[model samples]
Target: MSLMITDECINCDVCEPECPNGAISQGEEIYVIDPNLCTECVGHFDEPQCQQVCPVDCIPLDPGHEESREQLYAKYERIMAVEE
Candidate 1:
């Protein structure tokens, strides 16, 4: 599943650069994770980079956009394909 930044995000700018899929971006109020591009770092890393570096612990799996590990890898592949 994709990860989301909660309202607790301090905009420390840490998560933005950590996202390998480039899914995290600066929103009007805080950082926003794009579900379409988010694969929880499946194809890129063992763990979600954003979550690893988040100081506020605001990043969490989005239950609303739930998906299995296989599904997340598929999304990662699709995103990589588009980039290539």
Candidate 2:
């Protein structure tokens, strides 16, 4: 599953740089993770970087956008492809 930042985010800016996929971005009031680019760090790390760096623990699994490990890897590939 992808991760999402809830309203509980403090906007401390801690999670922004940690996201390997660059899926996390500043929102109107909190951080937002683009589902299309989010891979839960499958190709870059063992765990989600945003969740690791969030000070307020606002990052949570996006239950509404769950996907399998293979799906995550595919998403990661797609993201890297665009970057290249």
Candidate 3:
């Protein structure tokens, strides 16, 4: 599944840099995670880097965007392809 930043986010700005997919960004209120760009760090790390660095623990898996590990890997690949 993709991840989400809840209202509990403290706006620490830590998670934004940690997201390999550039999915995290400053929203009008709290930071937001774009589900389209989120791959749960499947291609870059063993764990979600945003969740690891967020001090308030606001990052959570988005049930709405659930996907298997293989699907996440494919998403990561597609993202990388576009960047390249």
What would the per-residue lDDT of candidate 3 be over residues 24-72, giving only the tens digit for each residue? 8999999999999999999899999998988888988999999999999
TM-score of each predicted structure versus truth: 0.97, 0.95, 0.97
* Model 3 error, position 24 (Å): 0.4
Model 1 residue 50 lDDT?
88
lDDT of 2 at 57: 90
What TM-score does structure 1 among the candidates reach? 0.97
Q: Of the pair 2 and 3, which is ahead by TM-score?
A: 3
> What is the per-residue lDDT of model 2 for residues 1-84, given as tens digits with 9 covering 90 to 100?
888888998899988898888888998888899988889999999988888887789888999999999999999998899889
The Cα RMSD in angstroms, rounded to one decimal, for candidate 1 relative to the true structure is 0.6
Candidate 2 TM-score, true structure as reference: 0.95
Model 1 alpha-carbon drift over 4 Å, by segment: none
RMSD of each: 0.6, 0.7, 0.5
What is residue 3's positional error in candidate 3, in angstroms? Answer: 0.2
lDDT of each: 0.92, 0.89, 0.93
